[model samples]
Target: MEYILLIILGFFAGTIGSLVGLGGGIIIVPALLFLSAGSSLFTGINPQVAVGTSLIVIIFTGLSSTLTYMKKKMTDYKSGLIFFIGSGPGSIIGAYVNKEFNLASFSLWFGIFMIFVSIVLFLKDKIKPLNQSSSGIARTYTDEKGQVHTYSFQPVIGILIAFAVGFFGGLFGIGGGSLMVPAMIIFFVFPPHVAVATSMLIIFLSSITSSVTHIIFGNINWLYALALIPGAWYGGKAGALLNMRLESKTVVNLLRLVLILVGARLIYQGLL
Candidate 1:
């Protein structure tokens, strides 16, 4: 029954994360923490361990979603690699810092961060594109429906932003897409599908770096991971396929609602 629950949790996390380009860690980490506090199966779980384990699952989720997106011609491979240059090292730093956080502090900050990401998502639609006045590398993409999108961003700024997002990802085990997808859409003017696809690739790379650091710290629960991985793996594929069918606006709205609810829950948990 415990394993069943873990599998279901992984599947749910993977589906939501991939559907919205979150990489699944956001859901996994928090759920683990909650289970630890509430149930015997996960009793005594710590934030570092949860974060580490969640990141491990993200590696699988990201790989599955990225592969799916790549096949659909939605992923921006070059851009993803470039962003990884910054996210990789940033993830390392965040994992190292994770060892110092107790559960309460971690929950509080993670909640705050989630709420902040939700706010950014709200602002994403309210803002206008900055690609016009921007001076940097410009790129173009055509979606499945033959609609064209043109966008640009300064590489230096993009790298800095990726670093920050990656730091948060490693710190919270969210894989960074909760922030990165919206940031890409708002700041880089990336089309929604391209941003989500690219985000998965970035998550795949960053999760590896973060999870490696967690491994060195001995923070992962490999046995628990055994249960979660299989479900998360298949769920990622399901999510990417679902993403192709959903409207971009619908996806963003769903993501925002989830973040707010999760964030509020975490904040309340921390206060106790």
Candidate 2:
């Protein structure tokens, strides 16, 4: 029955994750915490154990989404690689920091992080689009085929944001996609589809790193994590297909609302 519940939860988590470009940890971590509150999983270990286990599970979530994005060719390998270069190391550092922290502190910080993320999501809706007169370090690069590709901002900032996203991802057992998607769309002016795809790719690499760290630290629940994989796989594929049918603005607005709700819930849970 417990396994069955995990599967059902995984299905819901995966579907929402795929729809919004999160790594599923946003849903999975909270669900696990809620379920394990009075169970054996909560008795011996601190909240960090739950977070670490969620990060381990995110390996599958990341892979599932990455495959879906690859099938659609929505992933920009160049940008993904650049972002991964920074996030890879950052995730390791963050995981270590998480391991050193106590459970209460971790939960408090996690709640605070969610609140910050919610505010960012709310403010994102108010920002105006870039105008023609706006000036910045724009660059145009041509490939071997002589097609000119243009970018309106510096890549350096993107790398920095990726690092911060990765660190939080490792700490929270989430794929930085929740943060990366919005940042890419707003700062780098990436298309929503492109941002979603790129975020998945980054999540794949970062989750792999974080999972390895968790495993090495003996913080994973293998059986539980495995139970969630199949559901996430199917959910990711379905999400990729659905992405093509939805309007970008609609998706963004819906995701923002979801984030706000999730943030409020986390805060409420923390208070409780």
Candidate models: Cα lDDT each: 0.90, 0.72
Off by over 4 Å in 2: 38-45, 125-152
Model 2 alpha-carbon miss at residue 27, Å: 0.4
What is the alpha-carbon lDDT for the whole of candidate 1? Answer: 0.90
**lDDT, model 1, position 46:** 95
Q: After superposition, how far is residue 101 of candidate 1 from its true place, in Å?
A: 1.0
Highest TM-score, which number?
A: 1
Please write out the lDDT profile of model 1 over residues 1-272, one tens digit for every residue. 78899999999999999999999988899899989888987765799999999999999999999999989899988788888888989888999888999989999999999999899888876887666655687889998788898988777888888999899989999899988898899988898888988999999999999999999999999988989999999999999999999888888888898899889988998888
Per-candidate TM vs. native?
0.97, 0.86
Sequence-dependent TM-score of model 2: 0.86
